[model samples]
Target: MPIPSRPRAAALAVSAALLSTSLAACGGDSKDDVDLPSQTLSWKDCPAPSESEGGGEPPSPLPGGTEWQCATMKAPLDWDDPKGDTIDIALIRAEASGAEDKRIGSLIFNFGGPGGSGVTTLPAFGTDYAKLRTRYDLVSFDPRGVGRSAGVECEDAEQLDKYFQQDSTPDDEAERQKLVDNVSAFNGNCEKHSGKVLPHVRTTDAARDMDLMRQVLGDDKLHYFGISYGTELGGVYAHLFPKKVGRAVFDGVVDPTEDPEQGSLGQAKGFQLALDNYAKDCTSQVEDCPVGDTPQDVKDKIAKLLRDLDEKPIPGIFPRDLTQTAATNGIAQSLYSKDFWEYLTEGLQQAYDGDGKVLMMLSDSMNGRNEDGQYSNIQAANVAINCADDKPRYTPQDVEEKLPEFRAASPLFGDYLAWGMLGCTDWAVGGAADHPDVSATGSAPILVVGNTGDPATPYEGARKMAQALGSGVGVELTYKGQGHGAYDSGNKCVSEAVNRYLLEGTVPKEGTVCS
Candidate 1:
């Protein structure tokens, strides 16, 4: 699944991992031996906002009023040239609530953005992780090219607003060229503003930074919790340091085997399945069903609405009108979680009534566009990392060639997603398309969780990830539910199983399904 920093917007999902055969052995190799500094962290009060100020968001689950410690560490900007330039990585640590004797080592967290800010995500969701905080230090860091690190900055909010407002589903060649021109402008801005760091803001580089974190924290082995794109990081880390892997959990797994094109197609099919599920659920409702009773009817209605919006945009609260790209992103974001289905229903109803405010709100939330019209660096970092990790660059013609397969995979979302790949066609840095075979050979049992109806990362990819990790090493835990990431959302079975594994080193039996 393409794990966007925000709820997932603009049809872009970021993922990349290590290819086992391509990378050399971990230790003793010149490339592997970076003399990182060993420094003690001077703990200070974490800057977590109060519950009231946080809009009733629960305080961090850490004991003593949800306080945490923050610090920064230095790492080589380019792992290949360890002695070269350096960059700072931000970190947050909530000490174990339990007695010191009962505490386990640090449990690092990655919330899958190739661009998502761990600094923010951890504080917001740290309460759900209360079960683990008792026995382990809950820690997370913004990956390079992400928040608080050396972030990738592109256009300001005004420019980005115009960018998001552009038509993504082109009809004629002239319209297609407009799409290309917009992407080119965005890419050029990235190169102009952050080109120096863009090449190094890769998954492999982030994984290396993770190892540095482990070392500086004085942990002999690393214990990690990775979701979505973070799973790709964990997979790469396992391949890079199998011996250092300890009790890693990869939820909403990304298949390390697929190339960029294959990955995009797979995600297209996955999102289509999720849309189908939503349609079924919506049609069953006794009231407030915007679309007709049948799935095909619902699909046709939504498709026609999108087509209509493409022709005649709907004016909204914002200065700009609701374009097809924004509308599509708004619809796709709702598929990430079932909780948003009702809101989606409301938004679609409003759209039918010729009001675009609700859908525009959903679109803005998915894009990380705040009330002030400013955007988080999520989109910029997402593009940078995905393009840097995957080498495949498709031209407009190449995308046209693959349009049939993509459309067949997801008639509603395929065309936009297919065109999303073109953003990397003129990428400043060349990425390695083939991810290393991630057997995670010789590592401890790794937990892989999959949401059967997950729209972003499909259920089958999780099964494949487990199989690829080899015998006795990777175990799959199925959450037979909808949404992107499963643990602690609502499934007690999943939460407890993951808790047991992280706390007691207990691996769930194979084929364990949690509802």
Candidate 2:
């Protein structure tokens, strides 16, 4: 199944009070008088595995042709003091099967979730990444506060259910206040329940851990492939240790310098762009399409439908029903991938018919719900990382500041998602780190790919991120295609270019466009 591309939930605009401190220090060290523990790790002598992993036992082999193994290391919670409390970093390695002595260094892979679990996903889907796996020892790990690696867990299933039950878009002051209170309570709960792991969950710490993994594998240079927020993490790594970068690829890049509010407003516009594409695709199939001739009319119809549903939810069959939030989420998610247009049209038709089951399913997927009606840990991690990364600078007065742009860009979703910054105002965690610029002046050339119609990460972000990196350049792969990440979804031109870059260390020219 295609992964849904929702907006980064917690990237609020930073406050002036939070930007006074510098963010240039690397290895997690701060310039303050009180030094924090140095967040570094070194590998010790250990027996090499009889062979790389694949085909077998209790630990289970990775599914692809590559071989796999496990490694663990210790990193300090704070990065200045070498003696501070330590956290364990869990990693999995998948080695190339060519001539044993000719193996290139390890290639690290991360699929963007400030919470996405690479360790879990790599084993099964590692095959799709065969080009890189065949040349380097492919490595994946659970960054701190994620999956198997001492991940932070939150509210019980029921409370979490209640949390999702609350509306993300508030129609009035009472509803807005409720959202603020719920987000604050959620943040408080994370601090109370995961304090031991909270402070260590920063992206800088995760980058440090990646460096340690590079050492454990005995690689002097690092080759990395990071997607989505993974691009953000990769950017941070490149900034801190530019010289250590190997063949790095960042697809669906996020521009680090963008203020959250401005960035999200841009994202709202990007989504609308993708939605317009979806509408065109939908019209091609006259039977299932529900949109009107012009994009404006289609958008207006959607707005009226949402308002109508909000006042009186559209009921489904025996076991399902659609709340305003679910319907909205479904429409939003479908806009991310043109491949989803058919399904989205069906969903819209059902919503129009007062049976919201299909739309509800899309919403469930957007929120990561399982068949058993359980939610994944993704939502918590999404909120935590984003909140910790930036602070909300919007005030009641500021609401009017960008309202016109937002409304014009996203008719149905503008006000609701643009105002999502309010959730961070009540966060107990306070502000974010000062620096947002992540460049790799000393690292090898990294490949950054962008799709023109990406809803989550705008194409312009790809251009901006490429500009930020000292040695990197952005490749505007014109995906006459639509989707969040376009790497493995079959555009031979794109896959071949990326594969050649990863397997042979060939950086395509600056303005390389793959259609």
**Top lDDT model:** 1
- What stretches of model 1 exceed 4 Å from their correct place? 1-31, 47-64
TM-score: model 2 vs. ground truth: 0.84
What is the per-residue lDDT of model 1 for residues 327-438, given as tens digits with 9 covering 90 to 100? Answer: 8988887787787777678778888888887778777766666555657787888888998998777888998999999999999989988888787757788986566457
Off by over 4 Å in 2: 1-71, 286-297, 316-320, 393-397, 471-480
State each model's CA lDDT, in order: 0.77, 0.65
Instruction: For model 1, give the RMSD to the true fold.
Output: 5.8
Measured on C-alpha atoms, candidate 2 has an lDDT of: 0.65
In model 1, which range of ten residues has the least summed lDDT? 14-23
Backbone N/Cα/C clashes per model:
5, 12
Lowest summed lDDT window (length 10), candidate 2: 10-19
Model 1 quality (TM-score)? 0.91
lDDT of 2 by residue, 389-464 (tens): 7655555346556777888988777775666655455554644654365866656787888887788888887878
